[model samples]
Target: MNIVVCIKQVPDSTQVKVDPKTGTLIRAGVPSILNPYDHYALERALEIKAKTGAKITVLSMGPAQAIAVIRLALALGADRGILLSDRAFAGSDTWATSYALAQAIKKIGPADLIICGQMAIDGDTAQTGPGIAYHLDIPQITFCTEVDSDGTKVLVKKLIDGGHQMMEASLPALITTTMPHDYKAKYPSFLAAFHAQDKQTETWTAADVNADLAKLGLEGSPTRVGRIFPPPAREKGEIYSGSPAELATKIVEILKKENLIK
Candidate 1:
């Protein structure tokens, strides 16, 4: 089986900074890390590779600097890395971004399975994976917590509100994984790191992927960011200090005063 894993390079929340003028992230100086959710997807992909001896490819779309995340995937056990970077792909929302990625995967040719994280930290929209599946015209399973293989078919345990549902899909499908999908990701050894650093990743631009110029970047995005600002600060809590009965009366009084309870 040939497995394609999609990953993203996101700003480390601890070091995030915004561009005041553009109302966008200032990615140049911020420390970048692999999206935490993507790690579980990568781990699951590697586990599948280990069990079936399948070839694994890591794919990502971002600025040129995003290559670091791809190399990290290589160090973790991916056989190859593909970086989709270009001026045309800048400022793409989830829909356009997934469109571009789907084009790149088409350029990479056939694959048995595609894997991705449940969502990206930066956007957290959880739309890209399904968007890619839509673009690829393939069946998809989202929020998968467990995956099993029966040689020809893939069985996935999907997480729902109360429990998990098991479903089987044929090969050449896309899957988005969530927490505890597999064992914790392993640390890369020195040798793997060194080799990953030396590896030459395939780089593709919008043109290389045959993406339409009009539908490749911000131009293709239907949604626009009207404003970007931090959320309002939370108000201090009111504490009721007394016996249970008194506290209950005080809570009710406060709730009634706020018109929250009848």
Candidate 2:
């Protein structure tokens, strides 16, 4: 079975700050790490590989620096890594990004399964996975916390409103995973990391993927970010101290004065 895991490198949110004047992220001096959700997804793929002996290929679309996360995936047991990097892919929104990745997957040959994180931390837009599924015209299961496969079909435990949903999808399908609350990510040993440097890793461009120029980058993006800013600080709650009856009256008066009640 050939399985492709999509991963990303993202800035450490805790160390990131917004440029108030520019309404953009201040990336200078900020450290980057593999997106935690994607890390979990890679781990899930590795587990499936252990069970089925599936060949795992990690894929990412970002700047050349993004190869760090792909190499990390290799160290954790992915067979190979593919990085889709190009100037044409710059300023791509979720839709365009999905288009580019879908094209790359085709170039990678037939894949039995594709795994992705529920969302990237920097964007928090859980749309790319579904978009890729759409572009590939394949079935998809999202928000899964666990995944297992037998080389023909995939069984997953999906998170829903208040509980989990067990689901199954045939081969050549896509899945986006969400890590469990208690989940702890894994790192490779020094030896493993050292050996990962010898693994096969390739850098592909838009031209290599045969992507339609009209369907990539900012030109293909339908959504535009107006601006980004931190939410206003929350106001302190008003304190009330009185007898039960007095408190009831006070609440009624306040609600009425605030036009919250008739």
Candidate 3:
């Protein structure tokens, strides 16, 4: 089986900052790490590979700096990695991003499965994975908590609001995983780290993927950020200090004055 895992490099939440003028993230100079949620998806992919001898390939689209996340995926047991980077791809929203990724997947030829995290921490939209599936016109299962393969078909346990539902899908499908999907990720071995460092990740651009020039970047994105601002600070609470009886009376009086209690 050939599996493709989509991963992204995100700014460490602790170090994230916004550009006041543009209302966009200040990516340059911010410390970046692999999106934590993607680790769950990667771990699931590795588990499947371990069980079925599947070949896992990690794919990412970002600036050249995204190579860091791809290398990290290799260290975690991916068979190979690919980086899709181009100046024109900057400022792409989820729609354009998925379109670009779908094209890249087509360039990779054929695959048995595509896996991704439920959502990116920075964007929190949870749309890219399904959006990719939409562009590719493939069946997609989202918020998958458990996955079992019988060689020809995949059995999945999907998380719902109150519980889970089991479903089966044919091979060559896409899945978006959430936290505690199956197991914790394993640490990278020294050998794997060394190999990852030396591995030459395949790099592709919009042209390499035969993407339409007009629909490959920010211009192709349908949504636009209108404004962004930090939430206002909360107001201070009123203090009620005294004996329990006195406090209760004060609270009742305050509530009555505020018309909260009849």
Q: In each prediction, how many residue pairs overlap at the backbone (N, C-alpha, C within less than 3 A)?
A: 0, 0, 0
Instruction: Supply the TM-score for candidate 3.
Output: 0.88
Candidate 2, pairs of clashing residues:
none
CA lDDT, candidate 2, residue 214: 87
**Over the stretch 1-262, how does candidate 2's per-residue lDDT look in tens digits?**
9999999889997776789888877767789999999999999999988988999999999999999998999999999899999999988999999999999999999999999999999999999999999999999999999999999999999999989999998889999999989999999999999999999799999999999988888899999888988777689999999999999999999999999998
Give the residue spans of candidate 1 off by over 4 A. 181-185, 234-262
Q: List the residue pairs that clash in candidate 1.
A: none
At residue 160, give the lDDT of candidate 3.
95
TM-score of predicted structure 2: 0.88
Model 2 global lDDT (CA atoms, 0 to 1)? 0.94
Off by over 4 Å in 2: 233-262
> What is the C-alpha local distance difference test score of each model?
0.87, 0.94, 0.88
For model 3, the superposed segments whose C-alpha errors exceed 4 Å read 181-185, 233-262
What would the per-residue lDDT of candidate 1 be over residues 153-207, giving only the tens digit for each residue? 7889999999989999998899999987345666799998998787679999898
Q: Worst lDDT window (10 residues) for model 2?
A: 20-29
